[model samples]
Target: MTQSASPPNRALLELPQVQRERLSHIDFKLYFLGELRRTDVADRFGTGPAAATRDIAQYKELAPENLVLDNTDKIYRPTANFVPLFDHAPQRVLTALSRGFGEGIGEELKPMVRCEFPMALSEPKMSILAPITRAIHRNKAVRVSYTSIESGRSEREIVPIALVNNGIRWHVRAYDRRRKGFRDFVFTRMENPVLLEDSPITDEEKVDQDVQWNRIIELELVPHPAHPRPEVVMMDYGMPDGVLSVKVRAANAGYMLRRSAIDCSPDHSLSGPEYALWLKDPLALYGANNAQLAPGYRNPRDDSENKPIKAL
Candidate 1:
């Protein structure tokens, strides 16, 4: 759950979707990102060379123009006039690299220079998300024992709509049948989701009416004024003209702000090591557009007696 840990795109492809993800990943990193090694294929799918070889051949058979074998390197290189068969998303590529390094897929960690990354304190199990995914795809309702800072642990019936990444944590946007309102449920907080056989989506539970989830809001960020070297800070953020405009869904703005540690306080002095960036316009995050979610900025659980779902 490195914020980017999504279940592999399996269902959209043809039959034998079990291996669709492995095949797609091999081709994706090969043609779009870099060369694909059989070691990559083996490590990714936890399969031996024989199976990995078959997957590679299957991918080539489907999209023969994409990858060329480099015998000397024993790797598949992206070919000229290569076109991707499976769709690629930039975030997915970055996350795969992060997870690969974390799992030491192709490299031994001890030999590489170690760098600090914000470790995930809580990551929801894939077992929990799979049922939620099935429920959403089928537009069905589910039952789960959810532990929230607001309601604490309770059994509830929910019509799951979408699985969302609020930059740092994964959340499910669902219409609570009990509450009769939409709420964002942290994936980690859920337990034993049971997809109901007969539950159906109600008109009140439609995602289209969830304005905050759909509305996009832009926030301009600049290096904190307290930073001694603004020029260096500018280079760090790659800000052009001393400003970086970030467009994110209103519902997810709080997460980006909290993730970046951008101070939105009125007296927004840098608080700690995390607060290197500050919001240029505090109101953009706190004003009307993002009001419902952004007010509970950093410490969301503390203020959630009146809000739906705590801060990611």
Candidate 2:
């Protein structure tokens, strides 16, 4: 037996303006207002009277509405009870339009286009998004299976409070049941998250604000000759200086330290040895203060008791 050809995709449907407008009018009536006559809606949508009338009839079949025809005006209007529906219909329509067009785009591109998009396209395998969102809205607890480079794999129940996106990644800040404190779980590392129906953990049990804030670390660096000298050294918050310092806040302090260590490496050619060497006080290296090195300054790898300054 011969196989029948597959149907074409619905995305190929390109109805004319009159038909589209008529369909929208019917949608407005059914979802927002009551019923609207063909001629009246067509006129509002700037279509010819005859076309409007025909569209109205076609739309009525697709989406039925309880519309009444005004004897004097000959126009149809929604019932009094349905009047408030118009207020929210436009926003709903906009949201639908946005969602229809914006599903797979990256978050950075979402702002350029008029739509909401997911943060990452790799389809994070261990996603905590669903459970976390549910927890936030319902005020419940969530059970999560998490994995990390150091921890390997662990299970914990948490009270999700907020979702955060820090440029490169997404995190859920929650009160960890296992740790008995607040912690951030990287969404990409979460697996098999399930929401609990039990009552929400109280705010008194929430993670301490001080502990969260203490996660931040400030590091100062003086440029070595082999390293690249930025046009202007930037420390925290884009503050310019001759020396570079960075303030990194992360749940994983070791990860941040490793990154800082890499950036402070003295092997790069553009940053001479003098600028490449990591200084004890990155802030003090700014301006003329760098001309003199204070006693007790020592390189982590260097074992010499006192070594003379090496030019880049």
Candidate 3:
């Protein structure tokens, strides 16, 4: 009875929900990188030969122009006119090959990629982050036991508004009710959060009121006057004419500059392999709207009107 209801002539796109998603990955690998194999489809879905063959037949029925079987290799190859029905971001494709970190795809689901990249292992646990994610979506307050070098350990309730990645780590941009101000709480430092559904969330406590986060600062940088190999420096950073202009939120400007080893010195005299670039407009990231610098951040522009603050 069930077999009669669902005929063999079902539309390719009308396959069951889970199989459609699996086919999309096949489409992505074939169209984007031209490396889709029957084994890739088999491994991706944990299905044997018969099911994978059926999926391929379904896809071929739907889009015959997109892919053709290579009789020589006994594999499917993308046609010249191939178009992607899945994600096409360059970084997304590159990171998928990085293994274990591609969003939404699991480590067990994907085959091991051949390429290697230096990736840090530090990451927050899903259990600790789940409650915070829900609170952000629901506009609810959460209480967390946070540990920081400055405060040691303490419990506080905060209204989480946004999650920010400051290159190296994730931070929660939340209004700290205990401190009566907005603060950046490192995500990994927070533990065992309790979501407060009844707590009143106000617009004033959201990102709109985060002064440093809202302010944008421009940094004009050129090859360090001290860099002996100026041409190599340009190639190293993929910068043309030896100048790179970057805009960052005022709150994260310090971390970005420090990480890039950009000499913020006026004289551009900071010498070493570290100082391969120097800021052209050294004071561009100073106090926002003429207000004080963000907490714990020291402005090099404030220290020396004539020279850059030392990089050591």
Give TM-scores for every candidate, taking all chains together and pairing residue i with residue i.
0.63, 0.39, 0.70
Against the reference, the lDDT scores of all candidates come to 0.71, 0.51, 0.71
Please identify model 2 stretches exceeding 4 Å from their true place. 1-127, 136-139, 148-154, 161-169, 214-222, 228-240, 244-312
Better of 2 and 3 by lDDT: 3
- Pick out the ten consecutive residues of candidate 2 with the lowest summed lDDT: 283-292
Distance (Å) between predicted and true CA of 69, model 1?
11
Q: List, residue by residue over 1-312, the lDDT tens digit for candidate 3.
A: 011111233474467889777777777777645766777777767889888888888777776767888888887888777655544466766666555323345545452466766565557778778888899899899989998776688999998878876567777778899888877788788888999978888777777898888889887878888788888888987898778878887767766776667787667766789888878766685674322222223356566333332211
Regarding TM-score, does 1 or 2 come out ahead?
Answer: 1
180-266, model 1: which lDDT tens digit per residue?
Answer: 877888888889999998876778788887777778888887887787787887898888689888898776676667666777754
Predicted structure 3: lDDT: 0.71
- Clash counts for the predictions, in order: 0, 16, 1
lDDT of 2 by residue, 276-308 (tens): 335444233222211223322334444564354
- Please state the error at residue 305 of candidate 2 in Å: 18
